[model samples]
Target: MTRMPFKKLALSTAAAGMIFGAALPASAAGYTDVPKESSHHDNIVRANELGIMTGYGDGTFKPNGQLSRGNVVKALGKYVVKHSGLTPEEYVKTYGTASVPNFSDVPNSWADQELVMYSKIVKDMGIFKGSNNRLMAGNLITRDQMAEVLARTFAFRDLPGAPEISDIGGSAYAKSIEILFENGISVANPYHPRATTSRAQLATFLVRSYDKVSKEESVMPASFYSELRKGKVSDAIVQIGSTLTELKKKAGDPEAEYDFEGGIRHVYGKYEYGVPHPVLEEGDPVTTVTYYFDEEPSLEEVMRHMGPVEQTEEEEDPMEYDYLWYHKGDFEVFFEYEWGGDTIDNVTVKSNR
Candidate 1:
């Protein structure tokens, strides 16, 4: 049968949960090139785990490599398939073997016919408006184009106080970049709107977008399974006293990490784990566990979960926020309230000794 010509390519963030929800057996960053110091370390590693972004056969993740239209569609397709609540077997049965719409440039002999099929879904979704029967799959995607794609995918809402980025003056995608800025997503330091987006930047964009996208999807998309991705003290992967080694072994590489106080701090979305001072190099017995929420939990809710507050202390930066402390045997838990607020925005577990 003769295949019909296709029109476009694009994907939705709603499909990311399925891609990253499964259990990972080992470290997310097995790449030889990206170290903890690399700016792209966190995002690249996390993206790797999600299968939304990946490296070549070589043991290197070309963080600085430029992305092509073909690769972008493929990655987005993986995200959607994972989050669509269907297993690989189901996807293969439904999409892989099903009628795949063909792009003019993406030939029948393409190495991965699966990717060709994914582009079909993306085009069907209207992200890829392949002009003149051509889906320049080998062409690069500019930073501006990426912004437009993400804005449409995540349905970025207009927020106040958006930053003005450079190089998009009269560009058609200026509005898209504005939406990203308003939504608190930065593209790159230079904001090179016309430049091709790098692998590192793309990974960072996807990882950073998880929260924003989840919040926008009111029905509560199954981005990850509750059993697979744990949070909160009751279901947290790591505890107040967990060793750094244990944290890494269980949680994989953090999306962001840094040296804080004496030990190290790792950031996984809104969750932060820290181990400070003495035995810092050995990386054991975590010193703190902190989690932030988009909305502050009420005092009553805090008490309901953690019992009565034992003490309250005004922050040294008194205008910044206040802390409500509750003792848990040798451990201490604190509810942090932003100044002039009625509820708590963050909760932390730490050593009382």
Candidate 2:
């Protein structure tokens, strides 16, 4: 049987507009300790409103308190998850299972499960890193590490006109810190590269980042599922029932060919350009068109365009790879996540006939 392929979804930043919305309303939610007079009070309430950070059970958010690595991960991870274009519940089901519990210092016991998940979430998403192969959950996050986190989170680096900070000299964060300065997260004189970060500082950074991270230019990759249902992919104009002649007319001569199912599989390039064989003859209707991405697309970027994923009752997916497949009258759309759920490996569209 021909292998059934599936892919994970990805992010479209506009979906998180609320995260980057206008100034906090006068009636917006606030913490006990977050007075309007506080320097970071607006950002603190905004962060809390977005669920990126929260207050203590006593209703006080100690903004000036030092943030630990675990707390940092939790804050960044929550922001990523919320903006991933998936609802909190859907995000958990779609991405929560991919977090590998591998932090040496983070035990798999019930007590540390949340920490383990957030630690793995930020690590796998390339939002944060650990030291000496340890998560260092209890250690205070420094200015440099926080810079790296925000840089990775918003995909910011190499701001051409960004100002230089003399104090970050020779530090790894020298470049990434430019994002903070470029985006005006902080314009502190003599930026402290090694200083421990406070919750207030992190909240300020997250709030200030809204403009850059939630840019209107951010959108979903082309909808493979939608195109599949329409019987054609964007790059290749021919539809599923399209003849090899039509494909050749549109996509040019094949670069390679091999046995596919019972028919000949045509390959145009190294990527999954187009494959239209599930039969025994040279002349047959195109069976499938596969689009390959050089870079792995995130589930958030893909799903927003591909539409809702099919539901399964299973609490924890037992499959080795994350699979999301869809079926219409005569078409099948699939995206398989080989490495993990956040990054989609490939998307394949096939004629059900």
Candidate 3:
């Protein structure tokens, strides 16, 4: 847990892809201490604009100042509200009125009320923890601790393919740190997870985390669909949203066909090098792409590529799950997950017609 020297880190690929609309605009003279040439200037400005972090009344942002745990919780509470779509009033109503204390150190005093509430909320969500009934609110938070907070806040564990961190494999925050790296939030090679984070560093991390979540909730751009409509199909399209007509055009003809109730089922091998290999037997090691013109593609496929459904209907039947819907730009996609099965039986994507 030795601290590594701070160096200029590059903006992550995910951070670069973020729509500026997701973050507030930066002011030219946001903070006196943060020079325009500072590595963390953009993030600090963005955080200030978003009201996630701020400076002193004298217009100086102590960029290199150590961030306290209480302050971190306060900032993260605002972020959680934004990321989870909770109104500020709703958040206050939910956590503000609770009289029960989760930590012995967090007294019922008015001075500590806000921090205590936020601490309880984050703790309930498994983001923050206390040892020996004390939250250590005054202590400066470490980089690894920050990782755990972000990871739990955004539920980053569900994201696929977490990368390995050479130095922090054995730490308690290892998995969370890996998620941070995998999502392009932390680009530091020797991540220095145990080092105390500065206000500037924390601001950068929070803004990047927000960007990552925004990207996850986003769908493929309209330009992508325009390419798909023109029969320009690629591996990227398969991983996201695409029409059966487009998939057929990309994969060519199907090897086998079967009659279903409403439409014909066309089955194609997972094509590689312009060749479609056949499935010899049940459970064979082969790539299968099934397209039912009357029905949509698999639910798993849609969710896998398009992220989670934004809305879902409540189920009337106790045994059944609700139908899910996603609206991405001009596209509307629907999915129905079958009972006792991972595959989504029905999917339909419609454009503004």
All models: lDDT? 0.62, 0.61, 0.55
Q: Candidate 2, 25: how far from true, in Å?
A: 14
| Error of model 3, residue 166, in angstroms | 3.1
Give the better candidate number (2 or 3) by lDDT: 2
Tens digits of per-residue lDDT, candidate 1, 278-302, equal 5445467777887776665554334
Off by over 4 Å in 1: 1-30, 49-51, 56-58, 87-101, 107-111, 160-162, 187-190, 215-217, 220-353
Give the per-residue lDDT digits (tens) of candidate 3, residues 1-353.
21111111112232232121223333447887899899899988886765556666667778898888887876665454443333656655643425435777887664877676777655543456677868899999999998877655554433455566678976887877877787678888788888998988987887876565444423333233223322332343232233445555566666766644333445554321111234233222211222222333333334333333457665767688556565544445555565433345544443432
- Model 2 TM-score on a 0 to 1 scale: 0.58
* lDDT assessment of candidate 2: 0.61
Evaluated at residue 327, the lDDT of candidate 3 is 53
Error of 2 at 58 (Å): 4.1
**Clashes in candidate 1: how many?**
11
- TM-scores, all candidates, are 0.51, 0.58, 0.53
112-140 in candidate 2: lDDT tens per residue? 66666666666655565566668888999
Off by over 4 Å in 2: 1-32, 49-51, 57-59, 85-101, 221-272, 275-353
